[model samples]
Target: MSLPVNIDEYSRLVVLDDNELQAQNVAVSVRERLQRLRGIYAYWLQFPSKFDKEIVDYDMKKFKVGRAQAYDDLHLTQILMGNLQQASKEFMRWKINRDLEEDLRLARQRGDLRAAASIEKNRIMNNRTDKDDEPELEFDKIVPQQFEMTDDPTVIGIQKVPGLRDRIRKLEKKYGDTKIEDADYEEIKEEHDGNGTGS
Candidate 1:
């Protein structure tokens, strides 16, 4: 990169030459490749189980990319998709986008203005599809009918209030004890049940 630099008859060495420019171009190229791969990975995500040839073809055509690049992206996606055991709405969204993009790409490539416009319109309509189609979440649809929430201590206190005080009073009056707490074991009386559970 160190070539002759002449500035008004003054020549010196410079580290930045065509090589540096080429390096910058290389950086841009790598960045674009990564973005394309990421976009590809976002679609048809279920991997082997949900691998659709039409979907893959659509994505590749939409991306205006060769199958080699799509294959690379799919390989990487398969590795990353290992953890996704089930299909989700997110996947469906990506799948839809990929399909639309593919169709739009094909339309544009074929110079079919009408088809491209229609696809774009469909994409716009799809943006709000789930909004009217169904609830945002199953949990959001839970409309309780006279629902009541109580803490554990409050519930136990409420349930025991009616009988607890009366029982304590009866025990206190009967045994005449100050504590009125439960005994560990009842004395083995002569006419007790054989099970020993005091039943």
Candidate 2:
């Protein structure tokens, strides 16, 4: 297809080419030009008589055309500026709507319809929770307890008197000194008892 000449059309072309960088650059240029055009219109509106002649002269120089041609160019530029302004407004609205929809979806997922409605209504402003507004719970409160026991001494000890060493074998297995052979024990005992004389 043939390429377009209008700024908006050219921006769409850049976007459709799948070159985001080029598209963004074109959009920035278009936005700057649109802002400049709007400013000119505002100034002309405020001081029509003072600006009209200069605007016509500038247009004539820019397009290298006659007075009628300059008028046509200015009309077309105004129309394009209006369209750009509407497009920008629509883009902003779309972004806000999309964000609200996502927030509602998340709130629904978390089972909070009130939160979803608040978000939709734009009532949920602050993200931080107030300490005073939060509910107070007795987290440190303690409850009384009773216990029963069975024939197993280990279970009985644990239930009746917690932390009692219920099994000597298990305790020894865990942290006692290493077991000594009979010969090693006798040699150690003899040295300790001072029964060993100078060799």
Instruction: Report the number of the highest-lDDT candidate.
Output: 1
Error of 1 at 114 (Å): 64
Clashing pairs in 1: none
- Please give the CA lDDT of all the candidate structures: 0.55, 0.53
lDDT of 2 at 75: 48
Candidate 2 lDDT by residue in tens digits, 1-199 = 1122376663344324325535556566445434444444565565544444576566666546555444544444555544344355567667777788789899999999899888867623332222345563222232324456655565635454454456765798787877865663343333343565733
TM-score of 2: 0.26
Q: Could you tell me the TM-score of candidate 1?
A: 0.25
After TM-score superposition, the amount by which residue 14's alpha carbon in candidate 2 deviates from its true location, in angstroms, is 20
lDDT of 2: 0.53
Kindly report which residue stretches of model 1 are placed more than 4 angstroms away from their true locations once superposed.
1-26, 45-49, 80-199
